[model samples]
Target: MSVFDSLVGQSEVVERLKSAISSAKGGSSSQKMANSWLLVGPAGSGRSNAAVAFAASLLCSESGCGKCRDCQTVLSGTHIDVERFNPTGLSIKAEEVRELIARSAWSPSVGGWRIVIIEDADRLTESAANALLRTIEEPETHTLWLLCAPTLGDVSVTIRSRCRHLQLRTPSTASIEEFLLSNTSIDSKAAAFAARVSQGHIGRARFIATNQEARSRREEVLSLAFSLTDIDSCFKAASKILDIAQNQAESENSERDSQQMKQLQDAYQGTGRSLISGGARAIKDLERGQRSSTTRSVRDNIDSALLDIATFYRDVLVIQSGGEEILNIDLRTEVNEFAKTSSPKRSIERIEALLEARMNLGRNSAPLSTLEALFCALK
Candidate 1:
C-alpha cells in the first residue's frame, strides 16, 4: 500500500505537503514554500505519517507516484535520498545532530531530493536543537527538513517560526474502522471495538485488534477507575501499573538484549586475528544503557495507555458534572460506576494528577515515583 494510505483524516496536511513539493518542483517562484516544516499534532494524529509521505513525495519521480523506485525506497526507509532520525532514547545528542548535519552536506547519492525527517523533534536536546538550527536556518536547494512534534509548544520558537506548519487531527471512528478493514484482515466488529477504545490512535487500535493479551491488559486497566475506592486501592493500582509496565518492557526488549549480550560474549576469529573482548565493566555498562533506555520506553508506552484510561475517567467526571458529549464512552459501564462514587471534582482531580505525572515524565523524572505520587494524590 502507498504511504499516504496510513494517514487517514489528514487531508489538510496532505494538501499542504503536496503543495509545498509541487511549488518547489513547479519552479513558480511567485509562490512561497518554506524550507523547513513543523508538523504539529497530538500523539497518533498522523504527524509522522504525513512527514514520511511528504518525504516520499520529495523523492518520487512524478511527485509521489507511489510506484516509482524512489518512492518505494523512501517508504521502506532505504532511500539514499531520504534519511530519517527517530531516536527513542532519552535525548537527541549533539553527536547525532552533527551526523545528520554532515549527511546533509553531501548531495543525494541517488540524484534526487534529500530529505531529513526528525520523527520526535520534541525529544531533541538543547544542544542538538541548536545544532539542527544551523542547517535549517540556511538550507540548501533540493534539501527538505521535516520535523514531527506532538505540539507547537513542544518545539523551540526559533525552529517553529522558521518552518511552514502542517497541523493534523485525530481521525474519526468511522474513518479509523474503514481504514483498518481496508488495510488489514481484522474483522469489522473488532476493528470498530479497537477504534472506539483506542480513541483515534491507529497504532493502538492495531495493537488492540491484533493481540488478545493486549486487550486483556487494557481491560484490566480500564476497570481500575471504577474500582478505585480508597487510598489502599490507589496504591494497589499504582503498584499493579508499575509491575505491568516493567514486565511488558522486559517481554518486549529482554530477548534482544540477551541475544546481543550473547553475541558480544561469543568468541570470534576476525580477519586481523583481533580478539573481541567485552569486559565485565563494559558488559555492565551496556546493560545499564539498555536498562535506562528500556525504562524510558516502557514508561512512555505505559503512559499512552494510562492517558486513555485517564480520558475514560475524565469523560466519566464530565458526565457526572453534566458536561455534554462524553468523549470516552467505550467503557460506559465502568465509567458509570466510577461517576457514581467519585464526585465530578474527585475524578477531575485524579485526571489532573495523571496529567501532572505525564508532565513529570516529560521533564525526566522517574516514572515509578511519579506514578506513585499520582496515585497517592488521587487518593
Candidate 2:
C-alpha cells in the first residue's frame, strides 16, 4: 500500500501528488515539484493526511512504500526531518512560527527534504503569518512547507500566492461508507448510518460508528427538535444543550490537560517546593493555555451540536420537498413529524437560526443565551 491510500475520495489530489513525487525523484520536471504548498479542504477531508503522505513520499527512497521505516516515522510524527505545528489554543503565535522557521532552516538529517506541516494555517495571527511569509518567499533549498486551511481565503494572500494550492473535496457518502466498511469491523448498517449522519466528514463517521457515547450524545442533541414545544421546554433544552457541550469539552480536556501538566512537571525536573516556586510562572501559562483551549473546545462542540440540529431541519426540508435522501435516517420519524407540521419556509428559518447561533458562538457570545434564543427560534 502507498501512503496516499488513506486519503479517501481524493483521486485527483493523489494523482497530482504522485506526479509531484515523481518530479521530486528526478522524473520529468513537468510538474515543477513545488517547495511550498497550501492544502485547502473542508474539515475531515484529510488535508493533514495528504500533507503527511506527501512528506513521507518525498522522504521515502521508494516513494511512500507504506511499510518503510521512513514512511512509518513520518506518518507517526517521529521523523527528525518532519516538523508539525498544530496549535491547540486559539491562534498560532508569532514566536511559534519563528521557532518553526528556525527549525525549517536546518538541513535534513535523514531525508532529502526538511518538511514543515502546519495543520491550521487559518489560526495564525497576523504577525505569525508575516513571519511565515518571509520564509515562504525565500525558502531554503531543501525545505518544504505544507499549510492546511479550510479555504483559500483563510490565509493571507501574500503567503498563499507564493505557494502552490491544492483543494480536497468532501467525500461522497458511498465513499465514506465503503471506507468504514473496509477499515472497521462495524456492520454495513452501522456504516451507512454513520456515513449519512456525518454529512461527509469521514472522521466523524468513524467516531460515531465506533464510539457509542458519541452516538448517544448526538441523539440527545438531535432530539432537541422534538423538545422545543413550550417556553419552559425551550429554556430547558437550551440548558441541556449547553450542559452536553460542556460535558463533551470537559471530557476531551481532562485527559489532555493531565498529560500536559505531567509533561510540564517532568520538564521542571520534579514536583517539590523548589520546583513549584521555579515553575509557578510556567504553570500559570499552561493553565491560561488550557483555559483558552477549553473555551475553543466548548465552542467547537456547541457548533457541532448546532450542525446536528441544522441537519435535522435540512432533512425536514428534504421531506417537505418530496426528496427521499435524508441525512438523519434514524430520526426519520421526528423529521417527518416536523415536516408535516412545518412548511419549507419554517424549516428554512429554523436552519437559519441554527446558522446564526453558530455565528454568534464564533463571535464569543454567551453560549447559554445563544442556545436559548436558538431553541426559541426553532420553537
Candidate 3:
C-alpha cells in the first residue's frame, strides 16, 4: 500500500507527488523537486492528508510504502525529522513561528529530509508569516516545508509564489460513499445519507455516520427554519441555535481541557520555588489558550449550524426549480412544504442572510446579536 491510498478524489495530486519523489530520487535538475509546497483546497478536500503523504514519501527510502518504518513514524507523528504544527488558537503567533524555524534548521537526524507541515497556514499572523518567509527564502539543504490552506489567496502572496502550489477539489458524493463503505461498517443507506449531507467534508460525513448526537443537533438546527414564524418564535429559535452550538463546543472541549490541566499539574508537582513560579505562568498561558480554543470551537460549530441551515434553503430552492436531487432527502416533506410556501427569490434571500451572518461571525461580531438579526431576516 502507498501512503497516498488514504486520500480520496485526489488522484492528480497523488500523481504529482509521485513525480516529485521520482525527480528527487533521480537527481534531475530538469524536474527538480520543490523545497517548499503549498497545498490549497476546500475544507475536507484532503489538503492535510496530502501534505502528510508527501512528507512521508519524501522521507521514505521506498517512497511511501505504507508498511515501512519511515511512513509509519511520519503518519503517527513520532518521526524526529518530520515536525507538524497545528495551531490550537485562532492565529499562529510570531513566537511560535520563530521556534519552528529554529528547530527546522537542524539537519535531519533519522531521514534524508527534514519536513515541516503547517496545517492551516492561513492562520499565521503577519509577523509570523514574515518570520517564516525568510526561512523559505533561504531553506537549509535538506529542509522542506508543506503548508496547507483553504485557498491560495489566504496565504501572503510572497510566500505562496515561492512554493509549488497544488489545488485539491471536493470529493464527489459517490466517491465519499464508496470510501465509507470500504473503510467503515456503516450500512449503504446511512453512508449515502452521510455522504450527501456532509457537503464533501469527509471528517463530517464520518462523524454524522457514527454519532447520534451530531445527527440530532443537525435536525434541531434545521427545525429552526419552521420555527421562525413570528418575532417571539424567531428570538426563541436564535437562542436555541446558539445553545446547540455552545453545548457541542463545550462538550468537545471539557474533557481535553481537564486532561491538559491535570498533566500540567502533574509535571509541576514537587518542583522548587522558581520552577513553581514558572509553572504558574505556564498555567495562565494554558488557560488563555484553552479559552481561545473554546471560542474557536464555538464559532466553528455555529458556522456548521449555519451551513446546515443553508442546505435546507438550498434544497427548498432546488425543489422550487423542479430539481429532483436534493441534499436533505430525509426531510423531503418539510422541504416540499417550504418550497410550496416560498418563492425562489425568498430562498435566495434567506441564503444571503445566512451568508451575511457567517461573515459577521467570522468578523468577531457578537454571536447572539448576529443570530437574532439573522433569524429575524430569515423569518
Please name the candidate that would achieve the greatest TM-score relative to the true structure.
Answer: 3
lDDT of each: 0.79, 0.90, 0.91
| Residue 352 miss distance in model 2 (angstroms) | 1.7
The C-alpha RMSD of each candidate to the native structure, in angstroms, is 3.0, 2.0, 1.8
Error of 1 at 29 (Å): 4.6
Q: How far in Å is the alpha carbon of 348 misplaced in model 3?
A: 0.7
* Residues 1-379 of candidate 2: C-alpha lDDT, one tens digit per residue: 9999889999999999999989988887666688999999988899999999999999998888999999999999999999987777778899989999999999899888999999989888899999999898888989999999999999999989999999999999999999999999999999999998888888888999999999999999989888788999999999998899889999999999999998988878754545557788889989998998898888888888888888999999999999989988878888888899989999999999998898788667999999889899899
- Kindly indicate the candidate among 1 and 2 with the higher TM-score: 2
lDDT by residue for model 3 (1-379), tens: 8899878899999999999988988856688788899999998889999999999998888889988899999999999999999888778999999999999999999878999999999999999999999898778879999999999999999899889999999999999999999888999999999999999998889889989889998998999987788999988988888888889989999999999998888777756444457887988999999999988888889999999999999999999999988999989999999899989999999999999999899778998999999999999
Ranking by lDDT: 3, 2, 1
User: Which ten-residue region of model 2 has the weakest summed lDDT?
Assistant: 269-278
Error of 3 at 10 (Å): 0.6
